[model samples]
Target: MTATPRTAVVIGCGTTGTSVALALTAAGTSVALVDDDPGAVAEAAALGAGTAWTPGLPPADLVVVSTAPSAVADAVHDAQSRGLGHVYTDTAATKDIVCAEAELRGCDLKGYVPGHPLAGADAPGRDDADAARFTGRPWVVCPYETTPAWALETVDALIAACGAHRVDLAPHVHDRIAAELSHAPHLIAAAYTTRFADSSEAFLRLAGEELQAAVRTAGGDPWLWGDVLAHNAGPVADVLDRVAGELARAAAVLREGDSCAPLELAPTLQEGRRGQLALQRAGHGRTARDAPAGGRG
Candidate 1:
């Protein structure tokens, strides 16, 4: 396992892919940015990222798949068959299924790592690609037992180059945590926002910035979020079930108007407060320090 910087190929050329290409090039790696869209590749190249329309498989020293998780297996298989690179990784939100597919495709697990960055804007496409987008963000790295030590180090280097912190966890653990912390919230936000879409334009105009802020993430690419939620359905379902139970309890409390029931509301309120604090801390990169006093329901 060596740590020499080498040529890299970034597949997809979307915002994430372009960001990765730019980061790798900034780290002194010769990057080959690839995507199905010619315009996207050109746009990335214009930003000083490498240019390549057809990245004839195994990639350079590293091949990064920043596409949808549903497309990861096929991309990994193609890259392996072509001997595209010595190491491969993907920025897919769901990792356990992708890891399973990689094993099924006989990919060299020692040379592969699965990762997801915690930072992204509501905007989509290469036009929004920013090399500094991941700075100070948490980059979750889920590596299998067979993943080479060098591969993990290479990934850590890449994370640092992008000014992101690395958080290691197993694929299943990562998926479950993400479901509770990310997927469920996104679903809630989207649902909340959709309820107002039918309102009159004049009525909607009266909404405050607070309401707009709460639903901002609902504007992200639907297809991308669909692939993510679909791939990790089980974990998301588990969280949703718990949430449903809590909602039911809250409804019961509201209907009865008795705060002193066997199902105490205080504990639930406290937990919700703690979760909100944790979220705020994570968002601010201050997880090691005290969070703000405000809480959310």
Candidate 2:
């Protein structure tokens, strides 16, 4: 692996970026946090994550561009132009679009690996930047065949320092899986949760744990999730279409059902139970330590 980063720059002060800074700082790596919003940087700095980064400093060992998915290419290009670091990576959820745009922008691909840490809160709050957010989480790195060993190793070291496991994948594979595992799920949750937009206070107050748990991801940043869905639209649409079909069939069955009769929804319910069991067996819906570190790609 490449030598552990002695110094790093994180080009965002949101939860994920601040969490990265915090983890790196705790690992004894000197970190510089940067963001266009000075208040955000100040907040992160106040949390002792890192000092605010300014121009004119020597190039860092690595630079983590933790911007929104849509802004990744621009951030990488700008940071590289300014000689921010020797190696670079990003924390965007989708990879294909990011890599394509980066290449179109003429980014230095050899020095960069596209990555995503599968860890974050389901809501948009700046104060949720826990240094242990990535602990034992699976961090995926999408590297091109041309990506240099040093760049990959540098990112591996970053993931390791953050207490995450590295999973290397191709860009297309990463995007496809992210569409299924994250982007589509968030959209579905938000779509379902919209039913409560006009809900009465009494109705909402009666909401049970199941209802809350079902729409947990609906609390995430819509703008961010929208950008992510747009970036991986094709894959996400495919997943959504399949889910819609399943739900439509279930709806049809419900429409024809008798309340006192044996439920015909047994098949659908069984399938869902099986899927959940499979996910649990795969270490999801549980502690991160049980998560597999290998990528299917």
lDDT against the true structure, each candidate: 0.80, 0.88
Q: Give the per-residue lDDT of model 1 (tens digit) for 123-213.
A: 5656778887887678999888878787887787778777788899889999999898788777778877888878899999999999888
Model 2: per-residue lDDT, tens digit, 200-228?
99999998999888789898877888888
Name the 10 consecutive residues with the lowest summed lDDT in model 2: 288-297
Candidate 2 residue 227 Cα shift, in angstroms, is 0.7
Candidate 2 TM-score to native: 0.92
User: What TM-scores do the predictions have?
Assistant: 0.85, 0.92
By lDDT, the best candidate is 2
